[model samples]
Target: MKVGVLVLAFILAFFAESLPLGPLYAQLHPDFVALLILYWALSSSQVLSYFGIWLIGLVQDLVLGDLPGSQAISLVLMLALLYGWISRVRHLPSWEQLFFVFFLLLAQCLSAWLWHAWVGPIRWHSSLLLGPALGAALWPLLTYLLDQLQKHWPRRKTP
Candidate 1:
């Protein structure tokens, strides 16, 4: 069922995102959870509610040991910004959608960076952009794979 697949995808993404890559690699690693959220948010059917996304972000914050609610705010804001034009975005070519994902990830990253800069010590560097860049680069592949998964999933029964 769609819901089952959705839950599975999110679980896998959470674990993947939480992997212990080295310090440099970790910074460069794409945020798999955020990427999955974006994919589902832009899908033909709205797969995740706003609160669900917020909860996921909060979980990410807890997992990453960041301040609670920082990621929640960022992800909810990102979904709010995209919700208005999701239909239009769903119709875009995969390449164009990649650009959108890049901007979304960039914004998410910048928002977190700003939060850290405000309340905690964080080194400002050029490499902060790498994670978003890599996320964008991986968008097409993630989309394709998820699309296939969704297509193969059994349709939910209508009551």
Candidate 2:
């Protein structure tokens, strides 16, 4: 059931990323897929393995039509760093967690941007910098909604 929810969230995020918002609004849009990956990585139970993160990144890369491995690398690296310190991060205060999430989102976006720039043409624009900030800002809301959904999910009985 948890896996089902995660898959649904990933699908929703994939479609959301492709929404036809104008250029400025699109740049400001949060990277929902990255946030979902981060959320699962930070959970008490490891819901996604390294391979799962890589697969999600690959799907994101395909959906966005970017260089094949750019997003996969960024996401896998971010998950590696988070999973390594999940014990410590899970104990931090909410505000501090948000701060950390900001940097994580920023790093993911920056890495992807760098990859794109390295392989192909991309115009310099301030909006490019807005994505991570926007994603960080949306973190609380996303967390709350996912928490509610998880709490309400039916649990299986253990024999």
On lDDT, the leading prediction is 1
lDDT per residue (tens digit) for residues 26-139 in model 1: 789888888888887777464567898889899999888888887887888777767766877889977788888888888888888887888878898877799999999999
TM-score of 1: 0.90
Kindly provide the TM-score of model 2 when superposed on the true structure, using C-alpha atoms.
0.88
lDDT of 2 by residue, 1-159 (tens): 287677777888899987888876678897889988887777647456778788888988899886898889899888777776778887775556777788888888878888889998887777656888888788778877888888887787899
Q: Given candidate 2, what's the lDDT at residue 131? A: 85
In model 2, how large is the Cα lDDT of residue 114? 86
Q: Where in model 2 is the C-alpha error above 4 Å?
A: 156-159
- Which sections of candidate 1 miss by over 4 Å? 155-159
Q: What value does the lDDT take at residue 54 in candidate 2?
A: 81
> Each candidate's TM vs. the true structure?
0.90, 0.88
